[model samples]
Target: MTFRLSVERLVRIFPAQGGAAEPTRAVDGVDFVATAGEITALVGPSGCGKSTLLAMIAGLEPCDSGAVRAGAVTVTALSAEKSALWRRAHVGFLFQDAGLVDRMRVIDNVMLPMIYRNAKPRDRRAAAIAALERLGLGNMIERRVDGLSGGERRRVGFARILADPRPLLICDEPSAGLDADNTEEIRKLLQIARADGACIILATHDPELVTVADKVLPMRRGQLVAPDLALRAGAQQAAAAS
Candidate 1:
């Protein structure tokens, strides 16, 4: 099916942690459409609401207002119980921190999502093994996560998302802190995901990587700058320089 993830007037507010009077308006009534089989890159500097927008879309963070319509499901509007179920069955998220349990074995960590979703115990082991193998982490499956290097652990995080890919992939900087080769690996994995009709909304600062995006939305200080306006502005700069 050709799926589309749509966000309308998404907003998020964070209270001051240090007893400050004003709250932080992390996301300010942002809106956009992300289609299946293509990557929609949220290109911006740090603290520009990219992560905040994604968190609201993924239902991890509460939004003061907005509607998220991904196919038939109303993402941002789900109840707590339904929200967990919705994320497990339809959203394959790669959190910025790679949200892995430090005490678990690498394979077990990769399999945790399925375990939470109540998959057949007998089938999960084999599936986890396959996901690890596909990510070139087959030999390290038995290792504890704490024992692994940063890069190795990051790959394990990737394996977790691919263990059971959903229709939509909400990846937050899936390639951060990687060498050139591993970044390329992430790029290829994204291509494979898109080929299988998964909708990807990636938040990234890498311009070279953003080139693969079907639509690039620039954000700053919690507002989105439309791609059309951004393009025309770029062209004006080029013409003036010439």
Candidate 2:
């Protein structure tokens, strides 16, 4: 079944850290609709809640209040086991660090998700190889993930995302630390995924990557805000940190 991701008044709060008195609203009443076959980019600096929001949508994190729906399923209502099953069936999440098993061979890492989904061993292997080859990583499939460069590791992670081709693809800073060439490579892969009719939501600070998105949601202090305001706040935060 085709799916559209809908988040309604989604909220998540965390106890204050360090010297803070009030709890932090990690995601504050975030409501948005991301359609199938379109890319939605969440643009913000660190700690703006993009990652938390994505996690909630994917059922990886619990919501403090509100609802998350992916087509007919109420994501917010799922139990831990059901959430895992739901994610395996519909969501492909790419985290900032690529999240590979460092000591494993690249192909094995790519096949991990398929194993959980109970795909046949031979079929999963073939799908993994095809995905790796599509990402220009066919030659690296036998190499240990720990031995790969940063760009190569990220590519392997992307390969894993492609292996099963779930309907919803959520990525967190898929291009965090890479050279120009590697960044462009990721952009192309995102384009390819969109063409395959996946609902893609990505959290990123990279303006270049943002350009590829069909819609850009600028976030600040855990809320969707005006683009200029978000940009200014990000700038101010950067200055204060420096």
TM-score of each: 0.88, 0.92
Task: Indicate the worst ten consecutive residues by lDDT in candidate 2.
Answer: 176-185
In model 2, pairs of residues that clash are none
lDDT of 2 at 71: 96
Error of 1 at 116 (Å): 2.6
- Best TM-score goes to which candidate? 2
lDDT per residue for candidate 1 within 142-184, as digits (tens), equals: 8989988777777888888888788888888877777788778
**Cα distance off (Å), candidate 2, residue 100:** 1.4
Candidate 2 off by > 4 Å: 232-242
Please state the error at residue 101 of candidate 1 in Å: 0.6
Candidate 2, residue 161: lDDT: 94
